[model samples]
Each structure stands twice: as structure tokens, then as C-alpha cells.
Target: MRPTSEAELSAVISDATGPLNLRGGGTRLMGPFAGNVLETSGLAGISLYEPGALTMVAYAGTPLAQIEAALKSENQRLAFEPPDLRDVLGTSGVSTIGGVAASNASGPRRISVGACRDFMLGVRFVDGAGAVVKNGGRVMKNVTGYDLVKLMSGAHGTLGVLSEVSLKVLPDVEMQLCLRIEGLDATQSVEAMSAALGSPFEVTGAARGVDGSVVLRIEGFEVSVRYRATQLQSVLARFGAIDLIDDQERCANIWRDIRDARAFASGDGDLWRISVKPSDAPHVLETIGRNKATLDWGGGLIWCEVAKGLDIRAKMRVAGHATLMRASNETFAKLGRFHPEAAPLAKISANLRARFDPRGLLNPGLMGAAI
Candidate 1:
């Protein structure tokens, strides 16, 4: 089912009988696509775009491509760099802006800027009760009470179905440059990434491929990029020959691949995304043992391809969070898809769900048996 407007969406929810699968372009689905389905892609178009204000408000079903194109025209872009899930998910579907917010998707630039939630200024959605709810506001710098805007950002559409969203955007830098340092071991890679990130160069991206090649990115005015790249080179002279990647398209492709975890997309095993302290990454991975893993976000984010039934969770105890990025249906069925929550946090989650969706309706069983 597709509703082109909020009123249509509310009416659909008001009449919903059982579990309804909320879909936005169907790009980020995990587990089975059971139950009746509702698609938000029908609700499209940008409601507002104020380039001077660096703000854009679009209907939830608006294609991300549209937003990107519009932002590009104004020399601005989604700084968080939301990932396109089609390639990684091995599915053929265009990602919608709403899906990005629903999944709280962010990419390579997220390390420097922030996640989708950081730019999410406001949202309009339909609650489980079929009521039209608007939180936050159209313009930025809003402080009008309960921040349901954030609560809904990564809720996976469990709390509500997003009908519209307003986001904060940043102007695109004039130039993008990268330094590829090769031959760095895991420990060395972690240290190098940490040093680059801590430096005043304003490094925007840091990624280490499984082959021990680490890439560091810096973007800004051409002069600033050049000067900082030189300074950064001097600081990392000990790391040895650094190949500069200034070619616009190539640099973008590499960063885009890193942002989307495309490096592990073609691998055979199930994929797991582990988030840990940047400096603690090497130690954590050493304990996890060897499995094809790519490090991103200056070692804060690790993408590992582990085989089925490996119980990858038992490999480490970093006091960090782990997400099942991509896995077989059987694996999801046997083991919980997300990190196991402790009692205290689990209680809070339950309360939030009950407060917003007491009937246990929206996306039932997607996030741990609903309520």
C-alpha cells in the first residue's frame, strides 16, 4: 500500500488490522518481508528548499537522488553522507531520504561531521495510533521540549512512520584530497589514523582496507587542502611513501566505497559492523582473531565478514556495540540481530515503545519482539 499524503497515511494506519511492514524504497530490509506491506515512496517531492539557509524539507518518500542533486546545485551536500544500501544489501532499489533517517544512515564524512540524526532538524510522522505528529521544526536551532525528532531518527520506524523530514546541510568544500599510506600493520594503522584525526588538518575521512592500505582524506579550499596535505605528510613521514589521490572522481569513488562498506559487499560471509574506541580498535580486533575486516572512522568502526554459526559475538569484549549489518535469515532467527541490551537500557527501550506504540503494532518483531 502507498499513501501519497499524510492524511492518506493516517487513514491507512487507522484501519490497519495486523502487522504492517513499513517500507521506504525497500532498500534496508532485514529478516523476512512478512505481513502486509506499506510503501512510503509514493509520498514524494521536496516541500521546501532554502539554499541560503542551508535547510531543505522534503516528503519522506522523496528519493535521495533528488535531495543530492538539489543540494549540489547550491554548492551544499548532506555532510553526514548517508550510504546507499542497494549495493551492500545486494538488492536493486533506490534509497529514500526517509529510509536513511529511519536507519540513521551515515557515511565516511560521519566521522568528522556527524550522523543523519545530527542533521535531522525536524520530522513529521504518523504515530502507531494513526495520529499526525510533528516534532522539532522546519528551521534549525529548535528547542521546543521533548526531542522526539531524535528518538525517531534511528527508531527503524518502530515508533512512528516518517511522513516528512527537515535536515541541516553544509556547503561543499572546493576541493577533496586523500593520502594513501600503505604497508601499515593493524597496530600501525590504528596509530596513524589516530594521529591524523587528532591533528589540526581537519581530516574528514580515515579508512583502512584489509590489505593494510590506509587512506586519509582532507577537504576544503584548494590552497588549504594543499597546505594541510603537506603538513600532514610531514607529520606522517615516518609511515613512508604516501600516494596522493587528488583526482576528483577517483577520490570520490574510494571515499564513497568506504562510506558504504562496499569493500565487504562482495565477500562470502555474513557482515558485522563493530563500533569501538578508536585507539582500542587494534586490541579488540586482535582478540576477535583474523577474519576479513575493514577499519573505518579512524578505527572507531570495524566491518568484519564472519562465517555463519561462528558466534562472532564471543570473539571480543570491548564494551562496544555490534550490529549485524548483513546476515542470513537463519542467523537472524537464531541470534538477536542487534547487540544484547543490558537490563537497564532494555527497560528504557520498553518504556519508549509502550509510550509511543502501546498496541505493539508498528514494525512488530523487527526490533526485538516490539514491546
Candidate 2:
């Protein structure tokens, strides 16, 4: 169902057939799923902007490019640095800000700037009850009841269908630089990556790719970026470093994959995204070292493409949590890669789902077990 207006959106949600699968652009939803899809491409436009307050609100269906362009006009940007999913999903375009916030798709900057949820000021959505509810507000500070606005940031439409949203914006950096340390093994790479993050100097992006390399990004004024880059180079000298001058196109290309899990999209093997403590990376990778893997998020995230017949669940048990990035339909259905039920907080998740979508009609089992 296409909803061009709020009234149309409300009408779509009120459908009694099944729980609605709220989608913006329907990019990620192309994967496996079973539900009545509610396409929200109609709800588009920037409703309000307060430059003095550094806040903006846009319809859920608005393209991210439009929002970024509007924010750029004021020399501001979405600080969380949401990545374009096209790299991993092999889709044609970037993810919408609505989908980015809904999926909580933060990038390497998340270590410093914070996730999409943190920048969310408020939201306007239609819950399963078909009632329009508003949470938070356009202002920076709101200490009202439960922070439903923030809660919905990563709900992936399981709770409600977002009609519009309010977000905080940050001024763009004057300059940016990415420092690379090539030819380092995973162990050395992790060490250098950790040292950079531990230092007083702010290092924005950190990742070790499949090519046995480590890289970090520093952004700020020219003087600060130069100084921090030099300091980071000095610290990582033991790992044999190489300086990557920040070129707009090159920078965009390198980070596009890092942000969207593109580096691991080489073959048709099953793909897994593993999140773990940075220190435990070596052990986990050694355990699953046989599989093709690349490190991101400073070794905290492991992209492992496993051979067929391997037990992906066992791999997730070893690591903390794993998401099925790319896999066959048989693998997806049989392996059950997105296991929300196995998570420790599953019970509380069920309760929360009931509160937001009591009817269990929104994207049931999409993210696993309705929770």
C-alpha cells in the first residue's frame, strides 16, 4: 500500500489483514519476509527546521539525499554517519534516513558521535492500534514520560509505522584525514587501532580490512587533523603505517564499504556479521580462522563468510551476537541467523513489543520472534 499523506498512512495501518510491514523505499525488505508491506514512499518533505536550535524534522519517506542537501545548505550534517546499505545488500541506492534511523545504521563514527537513536529528538508514528502518537519534541530537551521517540529509532517498523521524525544535526567538519597502517597482521592491527582510540586525540573511524590493513579517520580543523594524524602515525609506527590523504572520492569509496559491509561481498558463501569485545577478536577469529573474514569497528565487528554446512549458530555462540548478512534462502530459513529468541533479553523484548504493537501485526518474525 502506498501512503502519500498522513491520512493515507493511517488508513494503511488500520488494515485488519495482518501486522503491517512498514517500509521506506523497500530496499532492505527485499530479503526474506512474510507480511503485508506498507510502502511509505508518499510521506516525503522537510516540514520544519530551526537553524538556531540545530534541529530538523522530515517526513519518513523523504530521501536521505534531500535531507543531507538541506542540512548541508546550513553547513550541518547527520553526525551519526549512517552508511549506505547498497554495498552489502548489492542494492542500487543509499538507505533513506528513515530506514537508517529505523535500522539504527550507525557507522565507525558511532564509537565517538553516538548512534542514530542518540540524535533522535522526537517522532510521529502510527502504532498497531492505528492511533497516531507523538513522542519527544522539536526542542533539545524534553523530560516527559517514556522516551518513545528514542525507543522507536531501531524498532525496524515492528512497533509502528513512522510518518515523520525529528533529528539533531551537527556542523560539518572543516577538514578530514584517514591514516592507514598496511601490512599489519590482525594482532598488530588491533593493537595499533586500540592505541589510537585510547589516546586523548580524537580518532573517528577504525577498521582492519581483509587485506591485512588498519585505518583510522581524524576530522576537524586543518591544524587539528594534521596534528592528530601525525600523532596517530607516530603511535602506530610499529605497525608500518602509510598516510592516506583524504580525497573526497577516495575517502567516500574506502569508507562506503566499511560502513555498509561491502568488503565481504566477494563470493556466494554465507556471510555473518559478528559483534564482540575488541580484545577477544584474535581468539574468536582464530577459532573461526578457517573462514574468510575481515575486521571492522576496530576488531569489534567481524565479517566472516563461512563455508556451506558450517554451523553458523555455533559461530554466534562463540562470538556475542551474529547477523546473517548474506545467505541462501535455505540457509536463512534453516540456520535462523537473526535469532532474537536466543538473546538474553528476549522476555523483556516480548513485553516491549506488546506495548508498542500489541497486535503482533508489524513485521512479525522479520527481526526474529516479533521482538
Candidate 3:
């Protein structure tokens, strides 16, 4: 099913008696999808573009490349710096703007600013009941009730079919510099990242390369970037030889992979995106049998590629959740996709799910039975 307009979408949804497999860009069509296929690609076009105000509202199916190119021309970008999961998900489909919002996919800059949810100004979607719903507003200071925009940010389309989204954009920084400190182990790298993040100089990106090298990014005005880099160099000199990957192309290449966890995208091994405390990184890695991994979000996010059937949630004792980013249908079914929610949280989640999707007919199995 394809919906070219919101009214057509409502009619199709209202008439449907079975679950619909909502597809956006097809870049993140992981896990099992039941019933029939419903494509959002037809709901395309940017309805609003306030470049001076740095705000944009586009149809859910608008290609992210289109939105990004438009933002680039205006010297602005989505403040959250959403990931292009096409490469990581091993799919060729263009990443859609709605896919980014549905998954709440954010990049390295998330550590400095925030995730996609933080920039979500508003949203328009068709709920499971086939009713059109709107939340938040086009401007930044929206004080409406319930905050459905946030509720749907990472709901994975279990709640509704997103028709449109409004977002806050940021001006592209004038300069960026990355301080690559060599030879630090995972734990040491986390410690270094912690220090950099805690310091006065604004570090936009922090990650430990697979080879155990630490890279920290700071962006701002050209003079401020240079000054901050010098200050950071002096502060982090104890870590070891500190080199600079300040060139735009070089820096972009390295951070792009880290942003999307592309390093582990090649293998057949199950990929886990664990959200643990920065300080608990080493323990979490040890619990996962010290698998090959890349640390992002200043160590709060760990992307590890490990053999299939490994029970990461059981060993993962930290106060965080592990999401199975990529795995086969058998592995997903056997091991489950998302971490099980706590009892109290589970009840609340059930209530919310009931409120949004009473029939359980919207991407029913994508989040697994526990959700």
C-alpha cells in the first residue's frame, strides 16, 4: 500500500483489518514484519522551510539525502546529526527523514547536542485507529500536553504511521578539529574521553578506534577550534602521541563510519548496540567476551560485533539496555531483539502501546513479544 497524501493514508489505514508492515526508505526494515506491506515513500515533499529560523517540516518519506542537501545549501543541518543507516544496515535504500526519527538515530555529535528526539519540534501521524494525530509545533518552544512527538521518536512505527515531521536545525560550524591520541586501551580511552568531555573545551565527538586509538572532536569558529585543540593537546598529552586529523575530508571519513557503526557492518556476526555508562564500558565489554567493538557517544554507546546466539542481556549487568542492531531472522527470533523492560516500565509501556495501537496491528512484531 502506498499513501501519496495524508487523507488517502487515513482511508487505507481505516479500512485495513490486519497489521501493516510500515516501510520507510527500507534502510531499517529489520526483524519480522507481518500481514501486508505499507510503503510511506509516496508521502513526499517539504511543506515548510524556514532557513533563517533553522526549522524544517517535511513529509515522512522524504529522502534524508534531499533534506540534508537542502540544509547544506542553507549552511544548516539537523542538530542531532542523524545516521545514514543504509550502509550499516547493509541495504541500498536511501535513508528517509522519517526513518531517522522513528529509530531516533543520532551520530557522534549527539554527545554534544542531543539525539533526534531533542530536535523534534512536531509530528503528524496516523494512529492504529486510523485517526490523524498532531503533536508539538513547528517552533522550538512548544508547550503542548503529552509530548507525542517524543513518544513516537523511537517507537519504531508500533504506534503510528508518521506522515510529517518538523525539526530544529543547527548552523554548520565554521571549523572542526580532531585530536587523535594513540595507544590507549579501551578503558584508558574511555577515561581519556571522560576527561575530554568533562573539560571546558567543547568536544563534539569522542570514540575509541578498534586499534585502541582515541579520537576527540571539537568544532566552532576557526580560531576557537584551533585554540581549543591546542588546549586539549596540552591537557591530553599524557595519553601519548597526539596527532591531528583536522582536514575536513579525513575527519569526515573517520567520523562517518563511527557515526553509523559501519566498521562492524560487513560481517555476519550479530551486532549489538549497548547503551551503558561511560565508566562501565570495560566491564560491559568484558561481559560481552571482549568482542571487537567501537565506543561512541563519549563511551555511553558501545557497538560490538559478536558471534550469534550470545546472550548479551544476561551478562550485561550495567544500568542500561542492549539493542540487537543486526542479525538473522533465526537469531532474532531465538534471542529476541530489544532488552526486556523492567516490570514497572513494562506496565507503563503496555499502557502506552494500548493507547496508541489498541489492535496491535502496526508493525506488531518488530519490537518482539517483550515490548
Candidate 4:
């Protein structure tokens, strides 16, 4: 079912008797759900944009490309650097802004700035009972109390169906410089990233590829970028030889590849995304014992490919969470899509789901068992 307007969306939900699998752009499909498809693509458009204020408001189903174009025209961007997962996931449809929020998608820059939820200012969603709930506002300071704006993000439509979102944007930088340190092992690479990230150079991206090359990005005015690059090179010189990539297009492509995890886009192995303290990254790598992995967010986020049906979680001795990002339906059903929360946390999540989706009809079993 596709609803063209908010009222139509609410009516459809209000009349629903079973699970409703929420869909936006059809790009990041994580479901083998038992429910009628509820498409939000029809509810697409930018409702507001203030370049001076560095803010944007768009309907949940609005294509991400459209919003990026608009932001680019004004020399601004969604600083969180949300990744385009269509290629990695092998999906064809356009990516929607709602999906970005639902997944809390962020790229390497996330280590410097924040995640998708950090930029969100407000949200308008239809709860399970078809009740329209609006929280927060266009400006950052307008958000107070419960902070449902953040609550809606990364919820994956379990609590409610997002209809619109307000976000904070950042001005685009004039120059970008990437410093590459080659031939470093995982531990050394993480140390190098830690040094760069800890520096005052304002490194925006830190990632290590399967090729054993560490890339750190610095952005701002041309002179500032050049100055910081020099400083960063000196700091990282102890690690290895540093190659400065000043070409605009080349740097963009480098980051784009890291952002999308292009390394693991192919092959038949199941993909897993593990999040842990940056310092514990080396141990996690040792535990997983997979050379085919991409470290982003300065090693806080690890994307590893493992053979299907192999439970990486069981092998993990680190204190972190692992999500089964890509797998067959059977593997997903057996292992579950997300890591099981601890008993106390699981109870809190269950109570939240119960409060928002009283009927337990919204994306049931997509994140785990139904509410």
C-alpha cells in the first residue's frame, strides 16, 4: 500500500489489522517479514530549507539524492555523511531520507562529527494506532523533554512510521585533503587513526581498507586544509610514509568506497557489522580471524565478511554488539538480524515498543520477536 499524503498514511494504518512492513525507496531491505507492504515513497518532497539557518525539512520518503542536490546548491551538506548501501546490499531503488534515519546510517566522518540521530531536529510520525505525533522543532534549541526526534531515528519504523524529518546541516568545506599511510597492520592502523583523531587537526574521516592502507581526511578552507595536512603528516610520519591526496575527485572516490564498504559488495559470504571501543578493534579483528574487513569510524565500526551460518557472535569475546547486515533468510531467522540486548536492556526496549505499538502490528519480528 502506498499513501500519497499524511492523512492517507494514517488512515491506512488505522485500518490495518496485521503487521505492516514499512518501506522507503526499497533500498535497505532487512526484512523477510510476514506483513502487507506499506510504501512511503509517495510521501516525498522537501517541505522546507533554510540555507542561512543550515536546516532542512523533508518528507520521510524524499529521495536522498534530491536532498543532497539541494544542499549542494547551497554549499552545505549532511555532515554525518550517510552511506549509500544500495550497492553493498544489491538493491536498485533510490535511497530515501527516512531509510537513512531508520538505519542510523553514517560513514567514516561519523567518528569526527556524529551519527544521523545527532543531526535530527524533529520528526513527525504516525504511531501504531494511527495517531499523529510531532516532537521537537525546526531549530535545535526547540528540542526539549523526551527528545523523541532522536528516538524515532534508528528505530527502523518499529515505534512509528516517520512522515517528515527536520535536520541540521553544515556548510560544505572549500578544500579536502586525504593523508594515506600504507602497509600498516590492523593494530598499527588503529593507532595511527587514534593519533590523527586525537590531534586538533579536525580529521573528518578515518578508515583502514583491506589493502592495509590507512586514510585520514581533513577538510576546511584551502589554506587551513593544507596547513592541517602538513601538521597531520608530521604527527603520522612515525607510523610510515604518508601520501597526500589533494585531487578532489580522487579523495571523494576514496571516501565513497570506504563509506559504502565497496570492498565487501561482492562475494557470497554473509556480512556482519561489529561496533566496539576503538581500542578493542585489534582484538575483535583477531577474534573474527577474517582478513576481509573494513574498519570505519576509526575502528569503532567493523564490517567483516564471514561464511554463511557461522555465528561470529559466539566467537566474540569483546564487549560490543554485532549485527547481521547481510545473510540468507534462513541464516537471518536462525541468528537474528540484531544482537540480543542484555536482559535489562531488552526489557526496556520491549516496554518502549509496547508503549508505541500497542497492537504489535508495526514491522513485527523485523528487529526480533514481535512486541
Candidate 5:
């Protein structure tokens, strides 16, 4: 349906049911078609701007690239640096502002800066009832009622259909550097990475691979980055980094791949994203050591390639959370794509679904009914 206004959009949604799929460019929503889809691409444009206050309100369907480009003119950027899913999905869909908030796709800088949810100021969306609603505001200090703005973040369009989003942008850093610390096993590397995070010196990116490779990044003024690079190098010497890469081109590409999980983009096998505590990384990885794997986010994220017949959910159950990053259609359908949670939370998700989508609509099982 072509919606020229918010009312038309609400009318389109009101009449749809039985798995309402919320789509922007239908990018990540690919694979299989299911249920009624509500496309927000028609409801697109920048509504308001507060450059002095470092804020902008944009329609949900507005492309993230557009927002970034506008922010670049002012040398400003999204603090969380949300990743573009196209790299991981192997599709050229322009990740929009709504999609970023919906998926909460934060990057390496998340450790120091914040998550996408952390920087979101407000949102205006149409609920399952097709009623237009607004939450939060363009300012930071408005903490009136329940934070529906943040609750909508990472909901993946399950809670509501986002029409517009308010965001916080920061002035771009002058310089960025990535320091490679090599030759430390997963255990030692995690300790070193954790130590760096705990220090007064701020390390923006911290990651370790299963192959005993660790990379740290610092972004700020040239002097600050240089000083932090040297200090971090000295701090991580116990792990024995043979070299440091401070090059601009190399640093940009490396972190880009890291944020997008390009290292494990081999689409032939099952790819899983396991999020575990830094301390439990070694133990959990060892538990699934037989599978092909790579560690990222300083052992916080484990990308494992498991056999088609293996119980991926069983393996992930040992960790705090996990997701089937990639898999065949049959594999996804038979084994399920999401990790299982406790029964109580399952009930809560059911209630939430009923509340947000009483007709059992809205990307049914896209994130699984249990979430």
C-alpha cells in the first residue's frame, strides 16, 4: 500500500495481521516471505535538526548513509558507529536509522562510547493498534514516563512500526589508531584486553582471535592516540606483541571487517555468534573447541562454524546468549535459528507479543516467539 501520510500508514497496518512483517528496504528481511509486510520506506525524510545541540530527528525510513553524510558536513558522527548489515548479509541494502535502532547494531567503539540504544533520544511510531504514539524527545533531560524509546531499540520492529527517530551525534574524532598485540593465547589475550579496558587510558576497540592474535584501537587527538598507543603497547607487552599497526588505510579496513564479522563470512557452513563474559570465553570456547571458530570483541564474541547436524542451541545454552548468524534454509527450519531461554521469559515475550501485536502479527518468529 502506498501511504502518503501517517494516517494512511496506520490504515494499512490496521487491516494487516497474522505475522506483520515490518520492512524498510526489505534488506535483512530477506530469505523467505511470510505474513503481511508493512513497508516504512514511504514515510521518509528529516523532520528536525539541532546541530548546536548535536541532535537530529529523522523519519524511520531515511537511509543511515544520508544521515551520516549530513553529520559528516559538520564533522559529527553517531557515537555507537552502528554497523552496516549488508557486509554480513552480502546484500546492498542501505541500513536506515530505524533499522539501526531496531537492531541495536553497535560496533567496536561500543565499549567506550555506548550502544545504539544509549544514544537514541526519542521515537515516534505506530503501535499494533495502528495508533500513532510518541516517546521521549529531542532533548536529553526529558525523563518523564517509561523509556519507550529505548525499549523500542533492538526490538527489530516487533514492538512497533517506527515512523521517526531522534538521535544523538558527537563531533568526529581527529585521529584513530589500531594497535595490534600479537602472540597471546585466548586466555592471556582476554586478560590483557580486560586490563586495558580497566585502565585510565581509553581503548575504543578490544578484540582477540582464536589464533592468539589481539588488536586494540584508540581514537582521539593525534597526541592522545599516539600516547595511548605507546602506553597500551607497554601495557600489553606481557602478552608479547611483535608489531603495532598505526596505518590509516589498514586500520579503517580492519575495524570495518571486525565490526561486520567479515572474517567468518564463509557462507558454506553454519555460522553462529556467541556472546559470553570475557572470563568465560576460554572455557566456553574449549567446550566447543572441536568446531571451527574465531573470537572477536576481545573474546566477548565467538563466531563458531558447527556441523549441520550439531545442536547449535545446546552449545549456545552454555553461554549468556547466541544467534545463528548464517545457515541453510533446511538447517534453519529444522534446527531453529534462535537460542532458547527460560520458560518465564518465554511467557513474558508471549505477553509482549500479545500486547504489541494482539493479532499475532509483526515478523512472527523472525527473532523467534520467545525472543
Candidate 6:
């Protein structure tokens, strides 16, 4: 089933008697689901764009590339810097704006800016009861009372099916430079990233590759970038040898690799994404020994490639959550997609699902057991 408009989408949900597998772009498929496929790709196109206002409104299925191109023409961009995981997940399709919102995908710049949810100004979605719900508006001040716009994001389509989205954008940076440090162990890498992030230089990106190379990015006017690079070099001299990458293309590619976890793309194992405090990163890496891992968000986000069916959660001794990002169907079913919530939080989530989807027909069991 494919919906072309909000009314059509509502009607489809209203009449559905079985589980409907909600999909947008189909690039982030978690596992095999038991339901009739409901594609949102038919509901495409940008509804509105105001360059001066730094705001954009697009239908749920609008191609993300189209939105980016429009923003680029205005010298602006989505500050969250959503990542393209098709290569890492081995899926082929144009990533849709709705999918990006549903998954709340953000890249390396999250360390400086925020997640996708932070940029959302408004949202339109269809509840499980076949009712159209609109929350927030095109501008931030209009988004008063019950911030459902944020609540919908990162919900993974379990609460409702998004029909349209309003987002806030930022102007493009004038220049970007990456400061690279090699031969740092995990502990040293975290300390270096913490020092850079905690500094007054305004670092935009901090990530550690699988080969133990740490790169810190600073973006602004050319002079500002150059000035920060010089100061950061002096501050980080204690870590190891430093290399400055001023070539725009090279820096872009390096950040892109870190953004998408490209190092783990070609491997043969289930992929896990762990979120922990920057100070606890080394411990997490030590716990999951010998696995290929890449650190992002200043070491708070760790992407580890482990043997299939190995549950790292049982071995974790720190305070963090692990999400199974890429795995075989069998592994996903046995382990689950998101980390298990605590009892109280689980009850709250169940109540939310029940309130939004009384019929339990939307992406049932995709996130957890059906209500």
C-alpha cells in the first residue's frame, strides 16, 4: 500500500485490519517484518522553502537529496548533518526526509550542534486510529504546548506515520579544516577529543577511526579556521604527531567516512552502536575486545563490529545503551533492535504506544512486542 496524501494515508490506516509495515525510502530496514508493505514514497515533493528564514517544509517521502540541493543553493544546510547509511547497511534506495526524521539520524557534527529532533519545528502525522494530527508549526515560537514534533522524531514510526515535516536550517560554513592526530590509544584519543571539545576553539567534529587516528574539525571563516587550527595544534601537541588537512575535498571525505562508519561496511559480522559517556569509552572498548570499532561524537558513540549473535549488553559494565544497527534477520529477532528499557520506562513506552496506536497495527513488533 502506498499513500499519496495525508487523507489517503489516514484512510489506509483506518481500514487496515492487519499490521502495516511502514516504509520511507527503505534504506534503513531493520529486519523481516510480518505485514503488508505500506510505502510512503508516493507522497513526495517540497511544500515550502524560505531561504531567508532558514526553514523548509517537505512531504514525508521527499527525497533527501532534493532538500539538500535546495538548501545548498541558498548557502544553508541541515545543521544536524544526517548520515547516509546505505553503504553500511547494504541497502540501495534514495533516502527520504521522513525516514531521516523517523530514525533521527545524525552525523559527526552532533557533537557541536544537536540531533535531528532539535531542528524539527513541526510535524504532521497520522495516528493509528486513522486521525490526522498536527503539532507545532513552521516557526519555533508557534510550537507551543505538547511538543509532539520532537516526540515523533526517533520514534521509528511506531507511534504514527509522518506525513510532513518542518525543519530549521543553518547557513553553510565558509571554511573547514581537520586536525589529525595519529598513534593515540583509546584513552589518549578520548582525552584529546575532550580537550579539543572543551576548549574555546569551537570544534565542530571529533572522531577516532578504527586505525586509531583522531581528527578534530573546526569550521567558520577561513581566518577563524586557520587561527583555531594553530591554537589546537599547540594544545594537542602532547598527544602525538599532528597533521592539518586544509584540502576541502579530503576533509569532507574523511568526515564522511566517520559519519557513516565506513570502516565496518565491508566486514562480515553484526554491527552494534553503543552510546556512553566519553570517559567510559575506553572501558566499553576494552569490554568488547578485538572487535573493529570506530568512535564518533567525541568518543560518546562507538560503532563496533562483533561476531554474529554476540550480545554485548550482557558484558557491558558501564552506564550506556547499545543498539543493534546491522545484523541478519535471525540475530535481530533473537536480540531485538533497541536496547531494553528499564521496567518503569518500558511501561511508559507501552502506554504511549497504546495511546497512539490502539489497534496495534502499525509496524508491530518492529521495536518490541506489540501492545
Candidate 2 local distance difference test against the native? 0.78
lDDT of 6 by residue, 197-277 (tens): 999999999999999999999999999899999999999999878999999999999998988889988988999999999
Error of 1 at 345 (Å): 0.9
Total clashing pairs for each candidate: 0, 1, 0, 0, 2, 0
Where model 1 places Cα greater than 4 Å from the true spot, the runs are none
Q: Can you write out model 4's per-residue Cα lDDT over 102-159, one digit (the tens) per residue?
A: 8888888888889999999999999999999999999988967898988888889999
- Which residue ranges in model 4 land beyond 4 Å of their true spot? none
lDDT of 1 by residue, 164-273 (tens): 99999999999999999999888899889888998999999999998889999999999999999999999888888999999999999998888888877787688888
Can you write out model 5's per-residue Cα lDDT over 223-323, one digit (the tens) per residue? 98888888877777777743677788898888887787776665556777788888888787777867766666666777777776566667544557877
User: Whole-model Cα lDDT per candidate?
Assistant: 0.87, 0.78, 0.86, 0.90, 0.77, 0.92
Return the lDDT, model 2, position 274: 78
TM-score, one value per model: 0.97, 0.92, 0.97, 0.98, 0.93, 0.99
Write down the RMSD of candidate 4 (Cα, Å).
0.9
The regions of model 6 sitting more than 4 angstroms off are: none
lDDT of 3 by residue, 215-331 (tens): 899888999999999999888888888998779888888888888778877777888889989999988877776578888988899988888888788888889989987888888
**TM-score attained by model 5:** 0.93
Clashes of 1: 0
Window of ten residues with lowest summed lDDT in model 2: 86-95
lDDT of 2 by residue, 103-162 (tens): 887888888788899999899898877789899998767749988887888788877888
Best by lDDT: 6
lDDT of 1 at 145: 87
Worst 10 residues of 6 by lDDT: 362-371
